[model samples]
Target: MTLYNNVFETVRMIEKEKLDIRTITMGISLMDCIDSSGDKSRQRIYDKITGYAQNLVKVGDQIEMEYGIPIINKRIAVTPISLIASASGEDNYLEFAKTLDKAAKEVGVNFIGGFSALVQKGFANGDRILIDSIPQALSETERVCSSVNIASTKAGINMDAVKLMGKIVKDTAYLTRDRDSLGCAKLVIFANAVDDNPFMAGAFHGVGEPEVVVNVGVSGPGVVKCAMEKVKGEPLHVVAENIKKTAFKITRAGQLIGNEVSNRLGVPFGILDLSLAPTPEIGDSVARILEEMGLEACGTHGTTAALAMLNDAVKKGGIMASSSVGGLSGAFIPVSEDEGMISAVQNGALTFDKLEAMTSVCSVGLDMIAVPGDTKESTISAIIADEAAIGVINNKTTAVRIIPVHGKDVGDTAEFGGLLGYMPIMALNKFSSEAFINRGGRIPAPIHSFKN
Candidate 1:
């Protein structure tokens, strides 16, 4: 009877609260595909990815139908292109990005990540080449996503990479201006990036990861929000407990889907990322969860405290549900992706500063936000620096995915269809950070970093 009741409850959550398997991401290592010739390397990569992921979408669809679960995406992540393409001594990696895009299309995945570089401490020759090619690569490829890890808790922040990314972002914006500078939407700059993240535009197959693995990302902000409504006027502790229980249920469901997918593909199960990723849908918003906690708006005075408790409870509950829980296992606050966040920004209830502050307690940082096209590159770099400092000091994974929509400004809307959503361009400070960003050097790791 109890098992039947639980199944019925889960069905209700799926029908009414938007519970979903956000993605089943297959991570493939390209380390073995490197060659002295760029063409050979590209061919090997294309063949490996398509061969491994050929049945990924088919299997995902089968499980979704068999179990009546909604799997939103079937995606792929590969070893950082910089590490593989560097062996070819290529001056540019545009063809590599195209190869990834082609492989993704062949496999029927929505996106393919890991056109990436890791230069937290310093640059490798391939890192510079990959970074240089990012703007053109992103502009030309329809499905290639890119990232750069420029900071880490132990390695500190790489300001040179940060500065370069700002200009790269601007160039991407210029190249894709016809599409509201959508190229910037596919790029992420990170601090303390995770090895097993199943989400994009920051998901990459770390060198330490297995040859091939299947990782699942689960999302249910609406489920948690609905649960919170049940305990309205209850003490904060009760709210926290309810959220944990809901999260536990969500995580368990995710593990079932993940294990099934892994077995079908003959790949190892990587991890279950139970992050409360939001969408532009009305009920499926993380900001709505915070508002349900008694705040008048999502960015009010107690917003950070509420978010801190919410993030902690979600992690605790997910940990209890599965030992394989990993990735950014907390609430995400991407502005354009969450309808409630977009409303809050338009109502003046949420400011850009408040969004940055909230990121200190949530999952990722400055995601899917649009700034004015005329905003200086130095300002964008400074924003990345601030978020990196927060992540480094706190020993957490944080990232920036801000978009400067060409010819768009405050009060203007940038349309990025589908799950990417749309947003009103938010205002930025007018002050210049040119002199500060010009000082290209590393910021040393925190004092507590030397735990060895």
Candidate 2:
């Protein structure tokens, strides 16, 4: 009866709540694909990715059908292209991006990541080339997503990369202006970026990772919010306990799906990322989970404290349920992706500064936010710098996926469509960070980061 009750409850969670496997990402290493000839290298990359991930989407669909679990996306993450393409001595990496896009389409994955460079401390030869190509690469490719790690806890922050990324972001927005700067939505700027993350646009197969592996991302924000409602008048400790238990259940389901997918593909199962990633749908929100914890609104005065508790509880529960828990394993608070977050921003309950504070506890940083079209590049860089500092000092991964939608402003909304959703343009400080950003150099690692 106990086993029967658990199975019944899980089924109910999937049916009534928006419980789902967010993505089953196949991480493919491209190190062996490198060649002296750029054409040859691209061909190798194309063959390797399509070959490894060809059965990925099909396997994901099969699992969803068999287990009655919703698998929202089937995706792929590859080794950073900078390392792979540098061997070819290519001045431009545009072809590399196109090859990835083509391969992703061939395999039918929703998104293909790792058009990336890791320059947390400084730029390598290939890192600069890849960074230079990002504007055109993202603007030209349909499925290719890009990321640049400009800061880390040990290596500190690369102010040069930070400053350059500001311009790169603006250029991407301008190039994709026909689609409301949709290209910027596919780009992420990071600090302490992890390798095994199954979610994009920050997902990449790290050098240390196995040649081919399967990573899973699971989400159940609506299930969590529903659980919170059950203990409406409960104490904070009680609320925390309930969240932990719910997270354990969610993570278990994710691991089951992940292991099955890995087995079917004949690849090792990687970590299960149990992030409570939200969608545009109502009742599916991290903000609502926080609000259900007795807050008047999502971004009220005690929001950060609530978020800290929630993040900690979720991690604790996930760790208990799965030994292979990795990736960004906490709650994600992307404004465009969460209906509750969008409502909070529109009602003036959430502000840009509050979002920054929230990132200190949440999974990622300043994700899927759309700022005014006229916002200055230096100001955007400054925003990245601030988020980087938080991640570096705290030794946690943080990323910025802000989009400055072309011809849009505070009173307007930018429609990105699908899971990318839509968001109102949020206001930013008019004060300039130009002079600060112009003082380009690396910010030294924190004192704590010096420990061996």
Candidate 3:
């Protein structure tokens, strides 16, 4: 591997820009694991996951150690259980989720996504069942994640599913209210969501992939932020170039590990998602990168412009680095996960409205944010609607993982602990969207929707 004298500088950049491989997710398809009998199908599901992924975490650790690059998470995303709809009865969805959770825990994986249903156009019986069961399933499981695809560039947003999800989010929060509504933390509603995203709670093995493949997600928001600090209010062009250069180094680190892991595991190497995935850690923050880029605070008036530039530059560098780069390849603005961002929100420097604006350029949507527990379900849906609209219109992927902490209101803090971090619930606009949102059938695809 080529080496450089800028190693320490690179690490400093990584620390500030939240630049690290967010996740190295192994996608394992289990379509062939279905059987006519329920018991046999259950066993097939477990065995298939275990047999395919027993070595995932172990191998990932080895790769991380050898490459000297941190792999923040090693996980597995499977074909959505809804695909094998006939294997289990509608009422039996929980068991399937249990089986998945079991296999994930046995493999030493933190989260296993793909307990999903694709309803961009419409829903199936199985999809409906899984959707309905999400609150219970998530409340009961330790590591299972659920996502619903309600919109896409071609199909537009699904208001029906979005409404259902709002209720589900509320219910999940209620069920886990004592635990900070963590069950809701495992859920996301997406528009144009990627099938091969290595990040959760939205990641799921795309149906088009091989039986087993490894995709890596690398982040370096800190790296970029550090670079921006060095430039210190240089012209916008220079700032963008600095971001690109920092991204290049981070992508190189991801490439080094991704290739080595794929080779060791004898699986096809997949995409390198060069997203700026922040954590609660002091230095790892996408928001901090923006702050370093001259924003007084991340949720301020200038934040969106800063984030948009940062997002575009990272993509430029990552695209140049690898042919397989994919997923939500932009700065992720998860409030709770970034100590700086959470503080910004708590201090009234960041607001939910500004957060929505930022998602237009960010990788994920409204992630790890906290709101009033009693906030209307329709308001939650409105938040989802806003994000889906941006994604659909721009033909890009966007998603929401908002957590309405039960019994908590604006300015009150809610702690999720660990990497999820503690969040201060930001105040919501008291205005109602009921009149506008209630009339929804579909937000028609954007004017740029023309493919021909």
lDDT of 1 by residue, 1-452 (tens): 99999888989999999999999999999999999999999999999999999999999999999999899999999999999999998899999999999999998999999999999999999999999999999999999999999999999999999999999999999999999999999999999999889999999999999999999999999999999999999999999999999999999999999989989889999999999999999899999999999999989899999999999999989998876989889999999999999999989999999999999999888899999999889999999999999999999999999899999989899999999999899999899999999998999999989999
TM-score of 3: 0.95
> Which candidate comes out best when scored by lDDT?
1
Each model's total of backbone clashes: 0, 0, 18
At residue 399, candidate 2 shows an lDDT of: 93
Q: What would the TM-scores of all predictions be?
A: 0.99, 0.99, 0.95
Model 2 lDDT per residue over 1-452, tens place: 99999888988899999899999999999999989999999999999998999899999999999999999999999999999999899899999999999999999997999999999988889999999999999999999999999999999999999999999999999999999899999999999999999998889999999999999999999999899889999899999999999999999999999989989999999999999999999878899999989888888799999999999999998998996999999989889999999999989999999999999988889999999988899999999999999999999999999999988999999889888889889999889999999999999999998887
- Candidate 2 achieves a global lDDT of 0.94
**Candidate 2's TM-score:** 0.99
Q: Which residue window of length 10 is worst by lDDT in model 3? A: 10-19
After superposition, candidate 1 runs with Cα above 4 Å error: none
Q: Identify the superior model by lDDT, candidate 1 or candidate 2.
A: 1
Model 3 over residues 1-452: C-alpha lDDT tens digits? 23465766565544444556678899999888777666777788889888878888888888767655677798989988787755566455888889889999999999999899988877787788888888988999999999989899888888888887889899999999999899888999999989778888889988887888898888766677667777886899999998898788888888878888898888898888888888898878888888887778778888989889989999998888886888778788888999789889867898888888888887778888888999888888898888898899878888989888999987578899888899877788899976666775777667777778
